[model samples]
Target: MPFYDIYSEDVRCGRGASKSGEETKTAEVFAGDEVGFVVGRSAMEPLEPHLIYHNGPGQVYLSQSTAADVREYEGDGNWFKISYHGPTNDSWWSTRDQTGMNFTIPDSTPPGQYLLRVEHLYVRYPIGTTQFYIACAQINVRPPRNGTVGAKTPSPEYMVRFPGGLAVPEYMYEWPNTRLTEYKPPGPALWTG
Candidate 1:
């Protein structure tokens, strides 16, 4: 895999193909199962403190558009529907520094095509001044074998928008007094159903 510029809104594996993606068929996992991806970081290190800090990383459901437009989902917010998040690990500084990160899809997730959005935050400046790196993986989800469709899916309340969901002043500002234990990933609450 090659390094993708964070600001370009390009699909991680697009490789200059197209920002929206080529409707390629990737992996298919059950609606409620474990999925994972390996994160790769640039060989070069950032010179600044915040740029070098690898504290928070997680995955979000970018969107569930058609087969051709699965990559249309991008950006940060409640609508992004973050499904899994890993807290800061003292052992690693960047996502690329880690391997085999995994998260589970909510059992109630709607069955469809999706773009799994993975992101890592390098907290260098202040609490709110964090930089983010994001990538997307194409996935197809099928209704469980039991043949019950939409019976265990999430409710509307589970749907959240990012910037609006995490618009609190405190969320943007982090200080030494902040309690790491009380930390919550930025976005709507996780949909555990």
Candidate 2:
């Protein structure tokens, strides 16, 4: 995992904490495989536990990408929101006290290289919820066991950039005291294929 060390905190309060990933070494996965990333440090919980991916050319080397910037691509949308973990009626937050956030690769996902992004917006921090922590890992997804399922090309509305993708909700401004009866992770909805 290419996670910037916790000691790197002094580097701008947790924005863009990506430690460059490996080019040759990549996590191999098949469609429908449940993959996850553990938080680098225990003190960190994957708030909003937003997991998204971008299938780009070459190592898919990108720290951030917006829908507009991705339109130039040849096929599926650049970034796809695979999953989002948030608070529930019974739990304060879904990602609390868990090994990590797990998401199944949609069966229709094309077999190729992609950038898996795990990000968390630290809500209760000296810096506030806007404090963003992000890490990108390289993975090579193989064909689904059933066969090559036709993948759907996600629309531009289904993609979002990292830094600007998560827009802080109005309730989070006064966080710690914000009455969050329902916490929805900010970003486009998950693109389930």
- Most lDDT-accurate candidate: 1
Give candidate 1's whole-model lDDT: 0.51
Q: Total clashes, candidate 1?
A: 10
- Candidate 2's C-alpha runs over 4 A off are 1-19, 22-24, 42-77, 124-129, 165-181
Give per-residue CA lDDT, model 2, range 12-107, as digits (tens): 213332323322255777877787776564335356543322100011111122223222221222466776765543224555445456778888
Model 1: per-residue lDDT, tens digit, 1-193? 3322433434332334344455545578676677766655465744333232345545565456544545453423223464655444433322334553677766666777676766555443333345555566777777665656463545567665333212223532344323333445665566665
Candidate 1, residue 67: Cα displacement in angstroms equals: 6.7
Model 1 Cα shift for residue 154 (angstroms): 3.4
Judged by whole-model lDDT over C-alpha atoms, candidate 2 comes out at 0.49
Q: How high is each candidate's TM-score?
A: 0.62, 0.62
lDDT of each: 0.51, 0.49
Supply candidate 2's per-residue lDDT for 111: 65
Residue 6 lDDT in model 2? 36
